[model samples]
Target chain A: MTLLVTVFAAIICTILWYKRKNDEMRLGTLCFLFWGASLMWLGDAIFEYAELHEEFFTPAPADMLNDLYLGLSVVALAMILWLIILLIKDPKGAVRRALQKK
Target chain B: MACFLVGAAEAIVVTVASKAIKASESKKELAVRSKGGEKAVDALREKQGIPWSRKLMWLAYLLWGGAFLLAYEHVWHGEVVPWFPFLTAMNDPGDTAEMLHEMSTVGVTMAVIVTVVWALLCVAADLILKRRANSPLENA
Candidate 1:
């Protein structure tokens, strides 16, 4: 259920970002990436919490699956930060010109 | 809860910092243009008439900062649950709590490092942007 929600959220945000490509597009893109990663992280956290509480009995395979999900979340976050740095940097030609002026 | 609060504070700090940097940049720009005989640029120096979009950008910065803080907290310490769940595979409640406390120490350290790096990057980006904006082709 949590995974579904996360995927849905990412889809919606991505759609919105594409729709606004010219208007603060970088900001929109960064936001979409950030939220997408966040939702995924939230989903895994929910699953881990459930496992910790023993709400769902998980076999060895399931435990491994949970670990994989957690690892993905970390990777997603790192990507989000990279996206942010790109967003914050001056847009393409803007940076090159800025550098030339210096 | 502590993480959330700290995140909120961080949001405010980032907002203020971004605004200060922008204002300074604009002032410097005005000073340059004024010296170059562009009297019209002096009007911008008053700063009483900043555009609405810039204001919105500042708000966005605040929101992003808050979200970053929230994510940092969530990663270090599990989200708070009102009642414990019934999963046996979970970490022990007592141990979880202890781990969270320890996690906060790590979180603080990480936050400081990330924030410093972010600030430095922003400064570099700003300088680069300013130079680009001042270029002759851009001015033309």
Candidate 2:
């Protein structure tokens, strides 16, 4: 479930990044982040599949909720990190000037 | 919170480790090249900063993605509400297939919402950056 979520996010991000390749919003970074996540999830799915075999596909409801929470949390964490990076880069020095004023 | 904590911890560890490795590599470059001087050091740093660090991006990706997947097995048996007041087809998870299909509907809706929000954020950030660049203060 988490793998599916990340893959979906990655595919969307990749398409967005490709279309806005020349933009200063640094879509490339976003693409890299999502794709990296997708790959990581892929690895996890493989290991789980190996361990649980057929049982992996039909997860219990409780299991699904946990996966859903995990998926949401991961997406949130990525957004947080990216926001921090954007602030640091402050491509326009907005943060820098704000700090200087302080 | 457990999922978030693990993800945050991994991000911090990966970033610090990458920075340490980069710092060490800088020193190694200085040792290997006797006459490259300050120019060489600057070049190395530039290379590191050009378009941002792949290590940093990958760290976020792996930690975020990996942590979530790891948490799934640990929490999969948890209960979830499966109800759609308007769409009867989307309600009542009688079995795994029906449940997953319902979940997929929710996932698609959430993903679409997230993507739209992210794009808007990028646009706002770009506008802020451009505004600063064109400011009278900057021109002065």
Candidate 3:
């Protein structure tokens, strides 16, 4: 699930980046982030499959649900991290203005 | 989760590099300041570093919140075991295997579902973008 989610994010980011051809949003950074995440998950899946062999074909539902949670959590964390970067950069100075308005 | 973390780390690297490049360019670069004491630049950022598809940002954020909340509820309720190998057949510490084979079918199923949903989201967004571009107001 994590792999799939990252793959999806990577694809979406890439498309948006390409369409806009603009880096002000740091879409390139975002696109690379998701893509790297997807690859990592893919590697983990492969390693687990290699270790488990045939047993990997069947997994308990509870465990699957756990993976789903972990995947979603990772995505959330990624967004949070990106948001931090955005706030620091403050491209439009909106935050600075709001803060200065006593 | 580990994979995602690693990806985020990689992204940070690229981001910092991009910033460094911009900072190096003393000439061709201008950092304007507003009355609010904020530095402004001529870049691709629409506002506050948001992408062109502002809706997409909010949508992704809302969905992520929902998923995170729901997942947390399930984890808290013990509906899903919080094991290290949640995706592997080794989910249960008690369960042991002689030889490894293929990835878990259940895991594959979950991955597929996530990918499908994501594809749908992107396709919908793309369609909306295209339509908006064609709208008379945009052309006018």
Candidate 4:
């Protein structure tokens, strides 16, 4: 479940990065982060599959719900981190401009 | 249970290697500057592709971030403990075997995937840089 969430994020970020005229947002970094996470979850999935064999596909309802929440939390955390980096880099100088305006 | 450790370990090694590479690069830049001043250093940079150290740094950052988050998740699930052995899986011999198996399989694959992706990104970046350098507009 976590893998699925991160995989989506990675794909979306990759597209954004590819389409960007300039790297103001540093979407490339975001893509790397998501892809790395997706890979990590993929590894976990593989291990789980090995352990459960046929049962791996049939996760319990409560387990699925918990995984969904965990996955969302991971995604949210990644976004927060990326936001912090973006602010620090200030590639577009938006934050700087706003601060100066203030 | 301790699968994230593999990525963290690789990240540590990569960070050290990146620092070493950066130091070597600085030395080379200094040598160039001594021979031909600042212009020479700029020329050297122009001739060189993006530093491998920077690429490694990217990998290191990715690994570290992923590992940290995964570690947090493990801790949330109580798979990891603050006590002596640290990992709950270590309590039982069978669980320890399973944990080791997960580490070897999942942990290894995670690291490998990140490395492969980083390598591909590096290749793509090099190609793009090469094209930009060759472009007439860029030269102008």
Best by TM-score: 4
lDDT of 2 at A32: 52
Full-model lDDT for every candidate: 0.50, 0.56, 0.51, 0.87
Interface RMSD (Cα, Å) for model 4: 1.6
> Tens digit of lDDT per residue, candidate 2, span B4-57?
233446557766876777677756667746668778767666554422234444
How do the residues B71-95 of candidate 3 rate in per-residue lDDT, one tens digit apiece? 3434544543567644333554433
Q: What share of the true interface contacts does each candidate keep?
A: 0.00, 0.17, 0.00, 0.41
After best superposition, candidate 4 residue B115: deviation in angstroms?
A: 1.3
- The TM-score of candidate 2 is 0.45
**Model 3 Cα shift for residue B126 (angstroms):** 27
* Candidates, DockQ: 0.06, 0.10, 0.06, 0.47
The most accurate candidate by DockQ is 4
Model 4 captures what fraction of native contacts?
A: 0.41
How many residue pairs collide in each prediction? 11, 6, 8, 0
Candidate 1 lDDT, B33-114, residue by residue in tens: 8676565565554343443335434344434543553455354344544345422213477755754563465334333443
Docking outcome class, model 1: incorrect
Report lDDT (Cα) of residue B63, candidate 3: 32
Q: For candidate 2, what is the recovered fraction of reference interface contacts?
A: 0.17
Ranking by TM-score: 4, 2, 3, 1
Candidate 2 error regions (>4 Å): A21-23, A97-102, B1-140
What TM-score would each prediction reach against the true structure?
0.39, 0.45, 0.43, 0.81
Q: Quick one: best lDDT, which candidate?
A: 4
Preferred candidate (lDDT higher): 2 or 3: 2
What value does the interface RMSD of model 1 take?
9.5
TM-score of chain B of each: 0.41, 0.39, 0.38, 0.95
